[model samples]
Target: MTKFDEQYRDLVFRAIVDGERVVDRTGVGTRKLFGETMRFNLQEEFPAPTLKKLFFESAKKEMFWIYQDQSNDVRLLREKYGVKVWDEWEQKDGTIGHAYGYIIEKHKQIDKLIQGLKENPHGRRHIISLWDIEELPYMSLQPCAFQTIWSVNRGKLNCQLVQRSGDLGLGVPFNTAQYAILVHMVAQCAGLEVGELLHTITDAHVYDNHVEPLKEMLFRPIMRDVKPQLHITNRTQNFYDFLPNDIRLLGYDSHPQIKLEVAV
Candidate 1:
């Protein structure tokens, strides 16, 4: 297994055996760990989890919604791409406030970040943030993978994401697959080779109800011999030009899907 897979498994196993139990927002209780980090070298292979199948289609749609569409409309995702994970977070007015894509749209974070990559590759200001303090109360949920900081070195693009919280069973894998796809897309558009993706989580936890499903994943053999490959069919240099059909996961081998109830 890749270190990405190994560390993910290790973290899950760690939570089962070593994490401290605490009641959380969902009231499901969680066996949680404080802080951890995992590195995935994009040059090596695509860092997709093989112990369990990833919903790459939905992940891609969600990522596209967050980055390209710059939207807070989960209804469109549900009707168009069958991505309903964010339905619970959608308010009655059909918006999640100035969180995530809403903030990106308002601030033009991705556009400016990509522009910086092309104009000033060495600039340290190439960052996109979704956590807006002013909009926190208006949002249904605070951002998790809140910020993305990009750096270009030697014609290769690297990215780091700081997530405030991670749900080990339900949210982690989707975030992993989606963000990895994003780095590849952005790198391709920016005409840089893929470098590495560093993911850091402040609070990583497995909910009580999710523990058993995670255990089943642990028992399965992870496709460790080789990692999957990502493909971008579009050669469009413009980051905003990417369509859902543009991204594809090739030769992604994995175990059967494991179902887990979402805490919220």
Candidate 2:
């Protein structure tokens, strides 16, 4: 089993077996665990989930929309990438408001991140935060995988994602793999080797409606022999220039996607 598969299975199992039943903002109740962490060595494997097929391309597009394009326009995602993942969160003005891309762009976080990693590989201050306190009221939905702290050691880039909430059935898979790809992209642009991706979630939950699907996902067999590897083709050294097509997941074999509803 891949590292992601093993860890995800354990998380789902624990959330169902030992978690507390609680009411949430979504109206859909959840079996919640207070905190959880997963570590992935990018050099060992790409950490894509093997039990269920990951929406890699759409996820990549969303990541680019947030970090690279630095845009909050939901229309652009729908029109250009044919991805409507954020459509449910679209505000009246055709944006998700001052969340994600808007905050990143406003602070020039990505630009500073790359510059920091390259200029001072040993710097302790590399971070990108999406949880802007003042912009919370304007956002359609608050950022879940909210912050990333980066560090470079011995020519390798390491990243830690601090997420406030994690919807185990839908969001966690995407967040873990997508951010791992981000580490690869950022490390490439910063001229460093890919290292570890530490994912820390403060509240990890399994929505009541999604429990069955999560169970099914856990029951599915993991493709233990296949090693998932991420391959990236860089046309430019700039991180902002990367498109979804430039990245690919090789040897990624998964079971058919288990349908789960997004508790919007």
Candidate 3:
């Protein structure tokens, strides 16, 4: 089982306040373009908050919906998981172009990424691009302005996420957890072990509307008992063969939920 600490939360808080203050006082949004830098060495610890219950299955399903579907239609997500977070972005034709799911649905890309890991394990350039600038006009929120790079070294998989803008308090937590799981999934499929996750955000700002809620979270004490453990079965070479139950998280404990607003 893995327990997340307050170090990331505190660092992100500072980055958001400082970045937002700079943009407010200087009228320059560049600070938002260049986000904050943070890293999580999974080898040292798994980064799930000890304060609130983090749902691992939900995170895994969401990731499956995005990269696996090749369609960003919220209805599909709702059908499988009953989540409508992207309902507003649904198109009239009942299709949402290569949002996150679209890329995963592509056969060539997935094969290439897997092959890259096996052939070039030490290369940091093993990246899976979700946001295509050319397709931005068709997207709803453009899948977090971040790009992800995943690599493997000495049988350990490492992941790095580079973001142009981030709503640190709300988005970062989910993004971090979900992507961390993604790294786990990829590593499992690639026959490798989990390593570290390095998250770097450019404009890591807590939305103006979420400031108070964040303050409230900071005041509450973290629940230290809940630990996260990953369970993966079916040692198959094909990533697509992985089912929902193939990977599981056991014994996750946390405090009450904290509500926060999103900038969208």
Candidate 4:
């Protein structure tokens, strides 16, 4: 079976239905339509997409643009990955304050997170928060309510992602894979084996325009042979030491691409 199969799909489906029902019946117009919780046992599988072709190149480029490049110029993203979603966020100085790369470089947040992991591997409070509430006013698109927590238990690394809002069509797929990779990388640096990834979304919603495509997914059969595996080439203690070549995904199989409208 794929990393995400019937079980995962069912849970998400149920949550969406319940949320929609609540909104329809209670007149709570603000009630969410698609919120879900997912837990991946790392020992069992590396949760990458196997039922559909996941654009690893795009994923890597986006990650690099956000966490590695210290610039917020959406032009770079457009040039490299054809992603110009941040065009409006660009500053006159050829930078954007809200860009992930800008934040990482400006505050050294990733380094701080790594230090926290090394100093207190067993601490329950290990977290790296990307969305700075104070900086929201400066953002082109305020951080979309994403938070990640990493912890160690008996030499295994566990990660939990809490998202207040999820654009399932365009964002969830990439978000899931990126965080999983983050967990893998952190675990490698900490000399710990990757354990589990728990994903919880408070207001996960499929855009109204994506409903038809999702219905199609329910009827389409999943490719059972595709399995995703992560190959890490470096075993360095420094998280920053990791290079693009150091990590790779293997044995991935999936269906044709499905497109959905992004509710920006």
Candidate 5:
């Protein structure tokens, strides 16, 4: 198991043992902690949790839908990539409205981000945010892992993801590995080496329905001897050129997937 898997297990344990039980917007409720952070050195190994299987293909396709496709159409995601995670939130017009990819496309955020990273590696202003207060009302669901800050150090590229809220059981694992892959892709496009991925969550919680399964995950034996790694097969100089097949995960051994309910 990766250090991240250990940390993830610890975080879940903390929530069960020390988190406050509270009602949330979902009505499913949560055992929540106010603030939490996880850091991974991309140079050592990938940060995917192995206690339960991660849907790597789905996560990769979703990331592409958000950044590369920059599309708000959930139908396109389903038809093109065979990913239906966003279908639950698909609006009447067959889209997620002005959330996520819409905002990115509108503001040309991804283009500017890639350009900024390439031109000014040491620039402190490298940031991308999906939370547009004005457009929030039209969105089916606001971006959860919404902001990213990029920094370059000693020929390495690092990313800090700031999430306003994270569902500990489901969303956290996907976001953790998803963003790590993003960092790797962006780093490659910028002609830099992989460095670190730092994730910060303002409100991290496990829904009431997920506590037991998470407990089961925490107690399961971890494959400590196995090491998981991420491989980027595409050397696409532009981040937008990346396709779902361009990335691959190697040495990912894990237990059976644990089913959990999404509070949405």
Candidate 6:
């Protein structure tokens, strides 16, 4: 019934009835589509998926791993956040080099983005790119949601997230929430209210192994009408000073967690 659930269900339904069968990097082939878009207005809702029990803590922690810690080390994620989602992509040296955090840290885009949002809100160049062409070979996995472009309209921050690939059952839900939160964080730092979040995925797909669970998720009813709220108590303008404790999710009443295997 909420925007998050509607968009999510629509995508799942698309994969079910219209998606084409195809081979992918993981031997677990997928029902694929070329492009799709979903939009969420921060003014209306925070856009947390209300239909399924999303790991809100893990989503926030992963965002912290990407932006706060600026780390590619999966071990640190496990140690700090109790999340092992990146363990498969991590190597012996404990890195997924130049993947997500590496790009932000390397270019210092986060700093520039906030500065640009303040100095030049409509610059048309406030962007962060995660896909590093030269460093691709060194990375254990290529960036999925590779780019994020930001803008300000009517003194409110807006974001357009472009993801090159998305796994419907697992990745998209978390990515959507994390990036929406990213928009909020940036807005708070830049002294602006939040606006719309535009998410565009180029290769959206559902893995073969996750079909059954995906179907089950589609059938489950959303438990409540109230959407989750993201509360950022950090008063500092400095983005790096934001500890995970600064952000919290409130009133996230939803259905049970849906177990679906990640395709490696």
Give residue 154's lDDT in candidate 1 (0 to 100): 91
lDDT of each: 0.86, 0.91, 0.66, 0.68, 0.90, 0.87
Model 4 weakest lDDT span, ten residues long: 22-31
Model 4 C-alpha lDDT per residue in residues 1-264, reported as the tens digit of each score: 765564445644654465453332213232254456778886666676544457776676667677656556777888866766566556776556664666667778777777787788888887767677777677666555357888888889999988777665556667777777778887877778999888887776655555667666666687777667878888887776777677788777677777764443
Which pairs of residues clash in candidate 6, taking residues 3 or more apart in a chain or in different chains? none
Q: Which is the better candidate, 2 or 3, if ranked by lDDT? A: 2
Error of 5 at 123 (Å): 0.9
Q: Which stretches of candidate 2 lie over 4 Å from their true place?
A: none
| Tens-digit lDDT track of model 1 for 1-264 | 866678899989998889999999989999999887888988877877888878889899999888888888878778867888898888998877777889999998887887789889989989888878889898888899999899998999999988889998878878877888888888887778889898888899999998888899899865757667888888988988889998888877788889888777
TM-score of every candidate relative to the true structure: 0.96, 0.98, 0.85, 0.84, 0.98, 0.97
lDDT of 5: 0.90
Error of 2 at 18 (Å): 0.8
**Clash pairs (backbone) in predicted model 1:** none
lDDT agreement of model 4 with the native: 0.68
lDDT, model 2, position 11: 94
Pick out the ten consecutive residues of candidate 1 with the lowest summed lDDT. Answer: 221-230
* Ranking of candidates on lDDT, top first: 2, 5, 6, 1, 4, 3
Candidate 2 global lDDT:
0.91
Error of 1 at 176 (Å): 1.4
4 or 6, which is superior by TM-score?
6
In model 1, which regions exceed 4 Å deviation? none
Cα deviation of 61, candidate 6, in Å:
0.9
- Give the per-residue lDDT of model 3 (tens digit) for 32-143: 3254566776655557775545655677777777655545667778897776556656777655655566645553566677788888788767877766777667765566
**Candidate 1 at 67: error in angstroms?**
0.9
